[model samples]
Target: MSEATDYSRETENLDNCDVEAAYARWAPIYDLTFTAVFRPGRRALTAAANKADGPILDVGVGTGLELPMFEPHTEVYGVDLSEHMLRRAAQRVERERLSHVVGLYKMDASRMAFPDAAFACVCAPFVLTVVPEPEAMLDELARVVRPGGEIILVNHVSRKDDPLAALDTWLDRHVAPKLGWRPQFPWSIIGDWIDQRSDMELMERRLLAPFGLFTMSRIRRLPLSQDVDAPVMPAELEYA
Candidate 1:
């Protein structure tokens, strides 16, 4: 058998060019275009986060579609690459009276502003594909989450055994990246990342409804003999 291809480099990398700008453009109509289709995944991830104690971080929180899904007691902070999208999220918070939403910050996921192990969990909904460097963002996710806490994600992952493997591959190279997301994203981009990490472990992987088009993964952060200092709120970072 031949060596397996690393599909992270299999595509043109076109989508990585202007993710923030692309999402800024999408902000105006993002909810209208995706709210219905993405609702189930939002519910699934938020419900799981709700069960855990302590604070939660919502990365790539576009237009804050999932903000209201959290239980009122769940203290949630949000971050996004798109200021345009985050503006809409602020409006949604006030309009919907989502008080559990602790704060919303305009920042890069790859280089977050929070302290190490600052959260109980981190949830990235349909986000891994949009960033220029997914591995860097994963590093930040692992950094901010407390040991034994979870890093949850929902993404469109492509598999070799998929019935549409041929079409997915064609689109990934020719079309998907241009659309600002790697719809035909290879599982190794994620699976291999998990395998190489000693601090993280795949706790759960499941397919979302309306067909197995989206995958939701939950990764647990293993406690080390030398854990980070206790999570603390940066005085300047936390909003009143």
Candidate 2:
């Protein structure tokens, strides 16, 4: 194959095999291996959900880890791209008798089936880097959430100045192939994308504990206005 074709095929194979297969293999040991790493973000997301009004959507709700944390009265829905993960999430709902969990679906975050303005709050935890097209997924989230709705994100952001930056880069280059995640995902690209959008207003940003490896952000979707500037894509970053 030509170099371009080879790269394309490799990317296709990675997309088809990486996410679902990796999660399927990890499903059995996921809680044991990742629960501690993800717990802080899950806690922050659920805390935000408890305070938000109306129904909430948990995007990338892997194994329903945050499902039980939601208040019993809050109506919550969850969606994940991996059927194996969604099945586990469904089982958790049943095992825990979580009455607040409205539904779980196998759905792509980039092209969600939800109707417009369906949720009051959208939470994406440790998911942005996993998706094939993070920008498209963010647009889908914006579309499904009501005006003035909150969007909460908790994910690891790469910092070039961090002491562990070199280690993170090395892992992204070497270990990511086996682990199936981009450990050194570019935070600058995501930041620039969010900054260019007129509809999204950054409300708060805080570094999560235990070495500040992750960041939690609270952003509000502004109500549509005629005066709002048309969203212009940043030329420096390509959606992937």
Candidate 3:
């Protein structure tokens, strides 16, 4: 088969394999294996959540990975694309006896089903890199969050002139084969894209460690008709 055909076939296979199904296979070992490496990045999200003013909605909340951060709150809602992941999150909620403070649902990130301005805060960690249409997911997130509320995103992306993009390209072509999905970094384009959107304001950007790596950004809804360009608060940087 041609290289393009091979890559296409591989990505299709990965897409066909349900993410929940794959996570189900990963859940039993999730905390010990995967979650451990992600603590630093998650910590940045916790800090953002603590600062947000309204109700929090965690999109793609696999196994409630970011749930603990919403402590002392009245309630937090979590949505995931996978039923199995939701099941896992439900179990965590019950284990923590947070039934009154936590709610879980199964939903897609690309096309959020919530009404406009339904949530006070929305978060999608590592979501942009995984979803097929990252911009669509962002649009949906912006749609659901209340005016002046915050959107906290933790994601991975290519470093300009870093040469790592080639590795990601290789993974998209090779490693993702049989897995059914392509590798993507939504953050690379996010900064420039958010700059153009009048509906949102870029509040902060943090550059994480190990070669200008990983990043977390907080974006808030801008007042209607406010100039997208204006002096704003200085962003913070976090090194992993």
- Using lDDT as the measure, the top candidate is 1
- Model 2 lDDT at residue 113: 74
**Better lDDT candidate (1, 2):** 1
Evaluate model 1: give its lDDT: 0.82
Better of 2 and 3 by TM-score: 2
lDDT of 2 by residue, 142-193 (tens): 8898888889998888877778899888988887756767788776756776
Name the candidate that leads on TM-score.
2
Error of 3 at 30 (Å): 2.1
Model 2 stretches with alpha carbons more than 4 Å out: 1-16, 225-240
C-alpha displacement of 111 in model 3, angstroms?
Answer: 1.8
Per-residue alpha-carbon lDDT of candidate 3 for residues 1-240, written as tens digits (9 for 90 to 100):
000000011234344255646666666766677575566677788777766666788887777766776666535777776666677777777777665345676566766557899887888876677666677778889889887788888777666565677877788777653332346464547876686687787888887654545678889887544635554544564344
Collision count of model 2: 1
For model 1, state the Cα shift of residue 189 in Å.
Answer: 1.6
Clashing pairs in 3: 13-180, 14-179, 14-180, 14-181, 15-180, 209-240
TM-score winner, 1 or 3: 1
Regions of candidate 3 where Cα sits further than 4 Å from its true position = 1-18, 161-166, 177-188, 209-212, 225-240
TM-score of each: 0.84, 0.86, 0.79
Question: How close to the true structure is residue 14 of candidate 1, measured as C-alpha lDDT?
Answer: 47
Model 2 TM-score, 2 decimals: 0.86
